[model samples]
Target: MTSKTIASSEPSIIESIDQLFLRFIVGKNKIYKEEEYNDGLSEAEQDDKELGLPAAEEKSGWNQRILLEVEKDRVKRVEADKRLKDKRNALLMRYFQQSLLKVVNDKLENSESVISDQLQLRENTVELLKKLLAGEPRYSVLASLLELNPGTRNRLLSLVSSEDFMKALGRDPRNVRDIQTAIGMIGTDVLRFLVPAILFKYRINAYSHHNTLFAKKLWRYEMTLGQTCTALMHDINYRRPYEGMLLSAMVNFAYVASYQQYLSSFEVVRTACLDQAREKGEKNRHDFFYDIKTDSASLQALLVSQADLKLSLALSEKLFQKSFPHLVNALKEEVEGLAYEERTTVGKILFKAVRFAKYDQLRSSRLFKPEWQDDYLADSYIEQDVFKNLLRQELFRFKPTWS
Candidate 1:
C-alpha cells in the first residue's frame, strides 16, 4: 500500500489527537503485539484499509523497542504519582477550590516559588489558584481544569493505561468492571479518560478464538484472543485471507495460554474454573490441583482414586503446557513432588474445561436444506471470500468475547 503524506501545516495537537483516534479505531491488540500501534501511520492511510487496502507495514524492532521504552517511562511516572493519590486529589481539589481551602490557598500563594517550580506548575499555578477560588465540586470541577491541553491529556492517560502501569499498580484485569473503574477514575480527571479507558479495556480482556466469552462479544471487542496471539506470533495481521491458518493456530494457543504475571484480586479464570467444576459436580478444585504439605496419605489416596478429578488434573497440565510452556516450568517448581498419576489427572480435567471455553465460529446449527446447499455453491469465489471475510470481521469485533 502507498503511504499518504500527512499535512505539514496541521497543528501538532490535531495531529496527535488524530494519531490517538487512529489507535483507538484500530483497537490494536497490545497483549499480543505492543509495537503495532506506535508505527506512526497517518490516520487516512490506516482508514484506507477499510476500503480493502493492505494492512500497514510493521515498524522496525528498534522503533518498537523505543516506543515500548517511552511507554514504560511514562507509566512509571504515572504509577509513582499514584502512591500519592490522596495528595494528588487533595492538590486537585485545592487547585480548583481555593475559596473552600483558604488556608491551603494562602500557603500555596505564600510558599516558595521553588515549590511551584518543583511541581512544574510555573505560571499555570496562578490560573489553578483562580479556579480553586471559584468553589466548585472536586470531581466535576476538576473535569474542566485543563492543566494540560486535550492532546497532552489524552497522551498522558494512554500512558497511565499501559501494561507496565497496570503491573506496577498490582491491578488484576480479569473483570471488566475493575478495569473500567480504574480507567474511568483516571480519565475523568479533566485529563481525557476515553483513550486510557479504551487502552485498559483492550488489555484487561481481549478477544480470543477459544473464549466462549470472546465469541459472544465478537463485534464489540473486535480482536479475538486468537487474533491477538497471532499478531504476537507473526508480528502483524498482514497476511491475506487464504494465509490465515497460522493465525488460526496462534489464536488457539492463546486460548490456553498460562498466566505468570501477578494477577489482581478480580481475575475471572479462577472463578470460571470453579464454576465449571461445580457445574460438573466435582468436589474441591483445590484438592485436585493443590499439593498439601501435611503428610496426609488419605488425602493423596482420595485424589488418586477419583476418576473425573484425576482427569481434570491431567487436562490442566496438558493445556498449560500447550498454552504456556514457560509458565508450566515455573509452576512445576512451585508444586514439586506431586504423584505422577495425580498430575496427569489434573492436567486432563483442566484441558477439558479450557477446550469448552473456545469460541464457536458457526453460531447457528448447519442448514441442511437442499435449496441452501445450491445457493452456497452458486456463489463465485470472490463472493464467497467476501461473505466469509465479512463474517470474520464482524466476529472479531463482537462483545464479551463470546456472544
Candidate 2:
C-alpha cells in the first residue's frame, strides 16, 4: 500500500521551482499578476489565477497601435512639404517679364539725345526739318530728335509739342488756342502734347490747300508712326520690332502733341489684340522686316540689326514722294501701275517686292543733289514769334500765303 505513491508522482521539486519562477517574472510586468497577488495566495492561488494570458495579448496590441500612428504622421509631413515648393516657382517668372519692358521704355526716353548729336545741330538752335524724305512720311523728327539732348528734348517734349516748337524755332507759326482746346490728351512726351509751341506749328501748317501742307504732313507722320507702334506691340514676329515700336510710339506721342482726333484711333489700335492688329499691320509691313522669316531666330536677329536703316530708307522714300514728288520721279522711272489706286494698295501689299523690283533701283539710286541728300538740312532763321504769327495767319486765312 505504501508503494511510493507520491500524489501521482508530483514532479521533482526542481521542475516545480522552474514553473514558479517563470510565473513570477511574467507577473512582475503587471500582465500575469495582480498588485496583491501574493497577499493571501501562494502556489495554489497562482494555479487558478490565469495571470499570463490577457497581459501578453494586450502588450502586443499596444505595439501595433504605436506603429500605425507613426506612419500617419509621416504621411502628413510629406504632404506639407509638397505645397511649399510650388509657391516659390510662380513668383520668379513675373520678375523677368517686367525687366524686359523697362529696358525698352528707357531706350525710347533716350532717343532724343541720340538724334541731336547725329545732326550736328546746336542744342537750342531752331531748325525746320521736313516731315517727309520720300513718298512715305519721314520720321525725320524722330531722326533729328535722336540728335538733340534727350534732357532738353524730353523737357521740351513734356512742356509742349517738340515738333511744334521745333517748327516755331524754324520760324514756322503755331496757334496756342487750337493746341489748348483740342480733344484727346494721352501724352507720352515729357511735356503736354498740346503746348503753345505745338499749336504754333499747327497754326503755321494748317493753312488751306498748299498752306496746310506742313501741318498735314506732320499729322501724317504721326499716323504713320502710330501704325508702326501698333504693329510692333502686337506682332510677335515683326522684324526690327524695337525700332518700329519706338518710331510708332514717337508718332503716337506726336498725335498727342497735335491734340488730333488720331488719339482715339491710336488707342483703338493699341487695345486691339494681336489677331486684329495683324490685319492692320500687314498694310504697313512693306518697308521693314514685318516678321521673322517663319520661326528662324537667326534670321530674326539679322533683320533687327538692319531694321533702323531699312525702315529709314523706306520712310525716306514715302516722305520724299509727299514732300517732293518731282524729285522722286526724277530719281527713277515711275512704275506702270503706281499711279492706279488698286496698284497703290498693291504697292503696299508688295512692299517687300521693292527689294526685288524697280523700286529697289530707286531706293538704291544715289542722290543727284545736295538738297536731296539723306541728311536733314538746317534752317537757322526759324524763330518762335515769326512762326506763331505765321501759324495764326494760316489758321485764320485758309489759304494764307506764308503758311
Candidate 3:
C-alpha cells in the first residue's frame, strides 16, 4: 500500500491577526543597513542626509530649524471642480474645519501660539502638521515616530517613515527637501498622544449632525486595511503595492464614509446590547444587531456601486493629485497593468480586512455583542478549514488602539 499523505493545517484567523499585529507592532521593523557606513558624520547627520535634507554645517548645541507655518490666514478656496464631491466627506471635512476653528479664530490672537475654538495645539505640533502636509521631515507620516530602540528604529526611523512609503501617497520626495533641513523637530506632548486628541474637545457641541470626530480614527483604521490589502495584492501578483495601496485607501475611505451616520446611531444599540448580553450564555441570548457598520450585504454591494466609487475617486483625485501627483499616477498605471479580476480580488481582500479590523476594534471595546456569530468565516473566499482556523486565530490578538 502507498503511504498516506496528510497536509498540516494553517494558522487560525486569530493567529493570523496576532501574527500581523506583532509583525507591525512598533519597533519590530528594524533598519537593516546592507552596506557599512564609513562617513565621519554622526548617525543623526546620516539620518538627515538620508531624508534628502542638508546636514548641519557645524555641531551647534541647538539644531537650526526652518519653521513652516500652516496657512490659516487665507480661506482654503478650492474651485467647484476642485471641491470634494463626497458630501459626507465634505461634512467630515467640516468636522476637521470646526475642530480647527475651535483652536483658531480671528477674535483671539497671540504671537507664540495659534488656538481656535478653544482647541490649543502646541506651536511645534502646528509645525509638524505643516511638515506632514508638505511631506517634509519624512517621519511626519508616522507622527512623532518615537522609537523604542535607538539602535534600530524600524526599517527607517519608524515603520511608516522613508520617502518610498510617503511616495505611495502621491507626494514628491523633492518637495520634502526644501522645507527644512532640521529633522526630529517636534518631540514632546503631541507626539505621545495629542495631535488626534488635541484637536478634539472633551465636550463637543451637539449642534452639527456630523459632530462626532471619529472619522480620524476611522482613517487610521481604514489605512490599516488599505495597507494590508496592498501586502496581500503583492503576494498574489508580485507587483509593487504603490497602485494597489493608493487605490485601496480611496475605496476603503468611501466605504467607511457610507457608515458615517451609522457610527453615531450604533451607540444606542451598543448600550442596549451590552446590558442585554450581561450574565447570559451565548446559547441563551436574544438576537440583536449591535453595530452601525451595517451588514455584509452593504459591503458587497459597495463593490458594484459605481456612483459611490466614482464620487470617491473623483474627490480623491481632486484632493490629492496636486500634492501627490506621482502617487496618483502610479495607481493609474498599475490599474492598467493589472488584470481586472486581480484588482477586484484586491478590493475584496480590502473589504475583508476592514471588516476584520472593525470587528477586532469593536470586540476590544466590548461592543461586539454577537460574539457567537463568526460570519466572516462563512465568506466564500475563506471556506477551507485552514482559512477557517486562521479566522479563529485572529481573536487571540490584543487590542492596541480603540481600547
For this target, which candidate reaches the highest TM-score against the unseen true structure? 3
Against the reference, the lDDT scores of all candidates come to 0.31, 0.29, 0.36
Candidate 2 residues lying further than 4 Å off, grouped into runs, are 1-210, 221-229, 245-403
Please give me the total number of clashing residue pairs in predicted model 3.
25
Model 2 vs. true fold: TM: 0.18
Model 1 weakest lDDT span, ten residues long: 257-266
Model 2: C-alpha RMSD to truth?
Answer: 38.4
Tens digit of per-residue lDDT, candidate 1, span 37-137: 44335544654554333333534443433346886677567656644653654453343233222322232232233123212223433243234322333
Candidate 2 per-residue C-alpha lDDT over 215-315 given as tens digits, one digit per residue, 9 for 90 to 100: 44334333333222223223335332222222322212322222221222223323332345366774333221222111112212222332223323332
Output the better candidate (1/2) by TM-score: 2
The order of the candidates by TM-score, greatest first, is 3, 2, 1
Candidate 1 lDDT score at position 99: 27
Worst 10 residues of 3 by lDDT: 25-34
Model 1: residue 136 alpha-carbon error in angstroms? 67
Whose lDDT is higher: candidate 1's or candidate 2's? 1
lDDT of 3 at 243: 38
Q: For candidate 3, lDDT tens digit of each residue in 135-199?
A: 43454344343222121122222322446633543433332221112133222211222222222
Best by lDDT: 3
User: For every model in order, what is the number of clashing pairs?
Assistant: 56, 47, 25
